[model samples]
Target: MTAHEDPDEDIPTGLDAAVTVKVAGVDQQRRHAELVKEIDDAQEAYYGRDKPFITDALYDELMLELQKLEAEYPSLRTPDSPTQRVGAPQEETDFSPLTHPSQMLSLDDVFSIDELKEWMTRTEAALGHTPEWLCEVKIDGLAIDLQYVNGRLQTAATRGDGRVGENITPNARTIKAIPQRLRPDPAQDFLALFEARGEVFVPLKEFAAYNDKLADQGKPQFANPRNAAAGSLRQKDPRVTAQRPLSSICHGLGVADGLAVTRQSDAYAVMKAWGLPISPYNKVVHSLDEVLDFITYYGQHRHDLIHQIDGIVVKVDSFAEQQQLGVTSRAPRWAIAFKYPPEEVNTRLLDIRVKVGRTGRVTPYGVMEPVQVAGSVVSSATLHNAYEVERKGVLIGDMVVLRKAGDVIPEIVGPVVEMRTGAERPFVMPTHCPSCGTKLASEKESDKDIRCPNSKSCPAQLRERLFSLAARSAFDIEALGYQGADAILRAGVLDNEAQLFNLTPEQLVTVPFYTRGATPRELKEPALVPPPGIRDGRVLSANGRRLLENLRTARHQPLWRVLVALSIRHVGPTAARALAARFGSMDAIRAAGVEELADTDGVGLIIAEAVRDWFTVDWHLEILNAWAADGVSMADEKSARPAQTLRGLTVVVTGSLQDFTRDSAKAAITDRGGKAAGSVSRHTDYVVVGENAGSKQARAEQLGVPMLDEAQFRELLEHGPTPASETPASETPAPETPAPETSAPTTRASGAPGTPPETRDRRS
Candidate 1:
């Protein structure tokens, strides 16, 4: 009040103007300071703590905003802007620390394929040509540098800050996959000194078994595999670390005898000879198309692998080219990590839903807000069973973490109880079946799942069983998903899934979907297609017509697939394929006794007995006969060959071939009826030799086995080992129209020209 009364006296008019002008400039400086502080905090959380407080999207947004502001107001910017630097300094550790020869940088990640292309374009522009690319699965684990002196392991250290790291040599020695010594090769060996860089990880099975042990002891389970690996490797006691199932895979060198390596492709071979483990999935491709194809295949089949991977890392294969491109402040200009969509995310658990399975198990599932994980949007995730539901403390209305385990099914990892509000409610397990109202009970004392008493008669069980039979790995009737399968069951189109072969579009167009209460719901409405429930009336439309078309398409499915679709316990695609390949026809397989079936290549006693029992069932036999009568493909249709030229002979391959990959060479041998043995023995018929051929060649000479050069190999292939016309087989029929005579073109591993698109996509 005193200042207001004397305002005119207190402020000179010219001073007031100056003070007002300073405010905008001061505010800009203040905002710039705030931005730097926030960015530093985020980097600290991500790099030092390994616990990111913000989503990647949010962090990227802040970085972009900071960059834009700095560009517009250059004077307000400082050298400390996150855009101008790498990660924060590494956290403190108790182990001995050593500085690296060069900074161990992290690769900048691009989440989308288009951004990946943009990174490639930038590299090409810098280097003045398209560089050869080498793609490897970006192993999701801790990075470590291993030093060697004259072929003996010296020290192993974890990548701490890029420049300095903690020594963990004692613990590293326990990993069997990482060699404590190397074999020196004159041409490629680091004769005096070298440093190898690679990843340390826990194999998936080992991690799972360790977690099981923890669960048995009433300890908290690991949230994810990566954490489990890191925690295992950094144990206080080296003996404890030794007990943990840890392994390593060498990627390439950090520094090699002070000489530049020629190519990254050669680096892998060098590491392999150094007694380090190499992943079979590694591939060297000539073009971007091939690289993309490799990534695509792995993306679809990551679950089939024994370990986990988050994405693929693409590098310029040439060491010279990489030097030309050089390094950035944070990452190399020649390499980029193309990250896959994350498999884990947090979403609100809106409610709980129960599902009845084909085996009558009543399982709980979480209905959640839609979230994208592993390339698909997931709206619901399995809670496994009632006991698990309670053990995870997954309350309805609480936020929960979801992950697509092995890129297969979505499942709840656990609940984020800290974020929960009082509005959240507890889940109550149902004592009766949700479908038929029958009482449920656990199958065994050790079992957590509650099973329904109603078995075959329950509509839910019937629908689920039919759906399983028609899964993509089975008959592959894509149009008949869960909703379509359930709808057809409720509509009484057929009593069992085997009757699906009898369906026609005419019958389907006339059959309307029925409500749970037996009320007729017309199938003509477009909105009813792919609906979730009968009461919900989601997808009860003319979808039946579309499904009928899909069902008809399934008739041509392979006999192995049909066998898998039969719902025989213990007999999946792999076992069924073994059966089909051995017997050649479904009829032959059905007539075989359990012992005979068990004799097949991949079939075990359990699977063989299950197959035999399934075929012996009267109802199953009737359904199979009816399906055959309805024109289903009941026999193996793969084009058959009588026998290859080199049948009944054994061959050994020595050294590396110019035109064939290791796998391709083996395949070629097997294709021609020769057993490809890794070593030459007295029984070996021939030894194919290449440059630098060594021990195998010496053994072959000692044993007096015939040797063949590349040109001679082709000459022998054209005429066949003993002329294919003389080959004999009792059952197999020779091709009516044989393929045009051609030289054994360089094996597929050689990246031969004119490879079909599908084959090229395999890259293996």
Candidate 2:
């Protein structure tokens, strides 16, 4: 069996016994030996041959299990335990092995927020107080240490076995991002002999382009960007390595002479001044809440960055604090990596099938072998139109690459063509709609998607509309999921969403899917019983009762949600909000000309035309009229508006706030008669900066726009900005919030309060 195979599979006595049967002494020794062999083999395959048969996650799990065993039985622990190693040992390769001046340790990982808090609590107890935390994106790339002598680059090597590594100086020099000579700083104390630790990576876009080039040349493509970077840097020929676009960013220092920085953030600034590449996303914060906010922000925006990131590495900023909590056998005690859920995995493409959406657009999606990624098991992902399938070169029965970034919809990246068998078949778009037997044709000659053109009566279209109506952005009916919508439609209970709010409890009882026996399945399973609303010895299922209740609650939703529930093409929440804010009622919107609707700030010509076209449809108007007749909201109620404290001002809110979500913050600004802008510019009156604020905060500072923290923002919302005449001539006309007490832990950067310090870098 390969090193990647499960250890239980290799166990002689079978799987269950290997786990459940507790063993001690000789048996523990045997199990320890088996784990060690398996882990060592995996390490060799991963580091030496660059053939990681198992995932990085699986490798970590195996190593963790081994550590637990050794901890329980001390005799099993050995000097050569895989847990004691930083990375795999280098085997005989073309490159010469070079020993690092200082051991290159890896980081301990915390998988959950609770675990991270535990680490912080322990750290705070150890130091007698909480230390300033430096947060940085953990770049998923190959680690390299660059040596410099007298400000000139000397050699570069990979992290082999912590103490020793393979020299790849020639390949490292090819990365243009890496500086060959440090810039001279006359006033600064420069380190004469130092080693900078950084990651060598292939940017996401460049990696895609390189993979496309390889595909055109009929060469095998790399699995992921991390692997691509490793493969590129480890090339035997430097010229071959140079062909791929490689980038580098220094996040840390390994060993140094004459270093003068007191904090990690300051060291990064020094590195930046010396012409070394450092990440712009690094941040320094005082509290655990701020750290969590930073993690949350990056977790949501990981893919938006240039390079891939597996997690966020948080370290104590102060050099003294880091020293007090020193290194372990394999990782630093001062730092821990908070890993985001895995985003990509390889799975088999079972088949490609077409789905008819609410607008009658037929979309092709791949049904794949179920694989867990991004905290969920995704069995299928959208392939979009038929052309997308062909463009991605994915075939039925091919092992394909699937990706799910955070909460975004899962999608098929492409097929693993190298693993395809001859039996794999290309997909063909259906000539007719499977739902209604209507001939499929594109609305426009140039359009890639084919539609059913039976939107009014197609079962598939009606079901999708019902599902869309219940979405959180629309009516937010809690019990009406895709399956619920399908069940109601299949049972003929909901012809369309017009009858959604009119669903009677009596009519629902006939639909067997929504009714159950009055008794619970068993006395022990009392939770399965429905609420006390039984009739005729039968009861509505919990979800059925919930659906009815939710429908009643949904009727009071705002005019914008009502508009979104109407299924107008191109009329999403933004456009709907603009239209509702402009016209106020359904009648006004229906009466408005396309030009008049298009004149609204956020509603463009396309959305305006779509809204107008939707109003003209007889069935669509009937659905709207029926819903209105059923007491569904058709107009936004005119309530007393808040005081226009920020009237005529443009404000921008970025990052997470302690008291408000992004939408809520924007709503607070707009409700008080201020224009909430997304990007900062010269016209921006104020930018409310929060924890983990990105480039917009910098842009605000560049243009001399006033900035406010959460407390200041609250003050501004209650009372207008301080008048220019009343404000001191030397200070900007912004709210003045009192600073945190000196005795309290400093919340700002490493230096003086109110003066921001430079951010640091992190490795995956």
**Local accuracy of candidate 1 as per-residue lDDT tens digits, 1-764:** 12211213222247654653374366766777787777656544432222347666777788787777766765443322444332221122246786766678889899988998898888888888888888887888899988877766667789999789987765676565565556555667465777888888876666777788888877767666777778877876665666666767677677675553588777766666555555545667777777777777567545534467889999999998988888888788888898988887889999998999887889899999999987799999888988788777789998988898554799898777679879999999998898999999986778788888676567888788788877877887777778767777767777776677887544454345522222345334434434333333232344454566677788887777788787776777667755765676889998999899997655778788878877777777877888898888889654752235565567677656789777667656654455677767777777777654544554455455677766555544455564332222222131121111112132221111211112211101
lDDT tens digits, residue span 7-82, model 2: 2222335553454344445677787888987776654443222234666677778888898897786545443455
Q: By TM-score, who's the top model here?
A: 2
- Clash list (residue pairs), candidate 2: none
lDDT of each: 0.67, 0.76
TM-score of each: 0.53, 0.68
For model 1, give the 10-residue run with minimal summed lDDT: 734-743
* Residue 190 of model 1, lDDT score: 63
After TM-score superposition, the amount by which residue 141's alpha carbon in candidate 2 deviates from its true location, in angstroms, is 1.5
- Candidate 2 positional error at 620, Å: 1.4
